[model samples]
Target: MCLLLNLFHLDLETLEQSNVDGPYEPMEADATNREHETEQGGTRFSDFIPLDFEEEEAVEEAIRRSLEEETVQVPQESRSIKTLTTEEITGIVKAHSEMVVTEGFRSIIVSRRNVWTSAIRQFRRPRFVESTDMLYVTFASDKNSTEDAEDLGGPRREFFRLLVKAIFQESGAFEESPNGFIPRLSVSHVQNRVYRTIGQMMSTIIVQGGECPALLSSVVLDYLLTGRMFDIRVSPEDVADLELRDSLKTIDQATTDDDLQRAIESCESWRYQIEGLPNPVTMDNKDAFVKNAIIFHVLLQRKSCYDQLAEGLECYELLPLLKENLPLRVLLEMPKVRSDLTADVVATLLKPSYSVLGSNKRPKEELMVVKFRDFLNSVQEREVEECLHGRTLTEAEKTFLRTLNPGHILAFVTGSSRVPAVGFQPSPKLSFVHNENKYLPVAHTCSNELEIFVNSKNLADNDEFEYNFLVALMNGANFSAV
Candidate 1:
């Protein structure tokens, strides 16, 4: 399958020149042909796998062992192990391939963008005439476009090149594809990350009490940009299908009143009667129904809980808007938080990231792992949590600490790698350093860009939410000058 994909495929240079940019008005003949293909039971691009292969448990075990063989440093403090993301797996796979990973190739692997799906559609055109999701789709210019040919755009073609590189990184998969390897596993991996991201964001709101417009905009923008909402999407064609409807019923991620109604209707017949039983769907009532639907979706049977939420939404209007908004649209265009920033923060915290078994650390070199969240709140301009636990600093380090500017906001992140600390039996106390970066000493902060140094994964818990509230209040009060 990989050989065929590589062999029949046009070179990247050829795709660049094959101009396909035009309006949406496809030829009547092409449309007729597509309709005929659907009538004749042609496989849709979404459903097509390169081969009828399922990955074996043995393959999974081998991959796991390969990862285990690579050394990992155990933290001084015990922690629930973090799960490896697909992006990290990509790196491991690349390393195993004994490939010299160039920066350009690495970018293609780490990209959350739909690299593979869009490319394969064009590669397998004619039979796979159906389109993959792309932002600025280039149509063949109407003048030149004929029943014989259609042009896919430059960006679309470039992605296929990236996809080819990604497959090469997982070179074993190319061979495994014939037996039972999922060629589109990369797409699925990214899609899962997107879903997890959404879950984390939603968790932030519900658990962390960040119901403010700012957090909402952040979540909406991430959701829009990632484009994985399509995973839960119920296309118009599938709207009436039981499988699609059941999925809607299960997920209950409706964005509008229409979607909400569809969700309730999708349930067994008895559920439909209850939807309009309270009030007919209307402009005035959609919001009300939506709130109920959310409650129903979550609680299912707990009527008292639904009443509890209804009482609150009526008073404060805290109903979560699952639909797109202007805030979301405006923020989507802004740049994302660079992964390197997080990487720097992580690097500074972990002394020896990976080590061989039974390795020893110098007495002074053992790191003090402070919860980053605490450090941010404690500092005026900056902080040295090391001092609190009796890790005395030299005169030079102290002088550097004093130089921290109070005006600059000291950046601290959540999570830390486990590290050894001295025996200090004392009550916890808060401390801070000057805010200015001028005082920062020593190198390395963000080490692992892909994996955050998370001490706790439950971002929505009560403590996390309350922490956000206090921080917001402090910031708000600080700005309210006379």
Candidate 2:
């Protein structure tokens, strides 16, 4: 019986330790075998017993709790990560070598060509033949260098050749590298060469259908003499005169390489002379000659020349000359003449009584009134004020308004008002005044009625005063009928 019981107990322990799903059946079998052995030669087998329901339940609950605990926590080994060094990172980048290319070279060459073209064109006429010829030679040098480079095949060689040729054709110039010497060419020389070649190729067309060379000659002479091209309004007769055309043809015939080179030097000398000429239109001395020239250019509708003249006039010390010669738009656009100054000037001009005093107060007012009247008349004739009023306020005006606060509104009203008002006065001493008290609410009904009566009855002779009084009342002034 003791043997059977020990055997049964061992089977139950094995069943609990094993992962088999039918541990109970295996336990029963083991128990039965042990019982048979006991019946054969031992005492009772009832001593060997299975687990009770309470013990089974406790075992299952313990297993469930163990699983929950395992799920809630993560193993420390699984959370660890590895890091890479700078050398390792560089190696990864190097392994991906397909990312870079030779496109940057082409972009650089294209940009160089664009800058070269713009600089050359700025002169209008080719004025540096030697430099231009050098540019052509440089292009040839580049082409030869590229051809030689093609012989040594590489990834970027063919593209380089194409680029060199494209730049050469576009610039009408070439580069050459001979015996380890790099030579560059100028764009002016190339343009002159191209023009001469074109002229020679189709002389008959120029002689027959083309406009006379006299026109070009006049343009050149005008540029030389006055630093200006002939106006676009030049009549055909001006160019077709036999003497002028013949003279022009003589100059045109002299368009050989050497002559063109001399002409370039002459043109440069002329440019230097113009630049060196004492700008009489400067701030120190407002030259009448320059002012007249500006007016003439303005009349001629030469915007570029006019703008240059205006720029020169900006340096003149005479405020009157500056004011008179400069276009309103140009004056307004000046960096030094800010919105405050402009508004002040415009506001002063708009007011009938405001005078720009210059030591002599009595004459100054008269002078101002006369000038203002004249200005008003001219502006009215041109409808300038209407046009300006209709236009939107510029950034400068917005900024001025921000700084001036409520003062700008007063100025705008005073300046833009028709049936011109008297000068703006902060107090009732003037015909039109700013009433601060009017901006406050009335305390009594009779005060409000008095305000209304004052507004309705224009007892003041000055229309501006009545208008301003009404404006003041509307803005919440206290008044009484008495």
Best by TM-score: 1
Runs off by more than 4 Å, candidate 1: 1-482
Candidate 2 lDDT, tens digit per residue, 396-451?
A: 53343233322222222221111001111111001121233342212111110111
Supply the global lDDT for candidate 1: 0.26
Q: Give the least accurate 10-residue stretch of model 2, judged by summed lDDT.
A: 44-53
Estimate the Cα RMSD of every predicted model relative to the unseen true structure: 23.4, 49.0
Query: Best candidate, lDDT-wise?
Result: 1
On the 0 to 100 scale, the lDDT of residue 393 in model 1 is 47
Model 2, which residues run further than 4 Å from truth? Answer: 1-339, 342-407, 414-430, 433-482
Write candidate 1's Cα lDDT for 303-379 as tens digits: 22222222222211122221211221211111122111122222232223332345442211222123333433333
State in Å the error of residue 12, model 1: 30
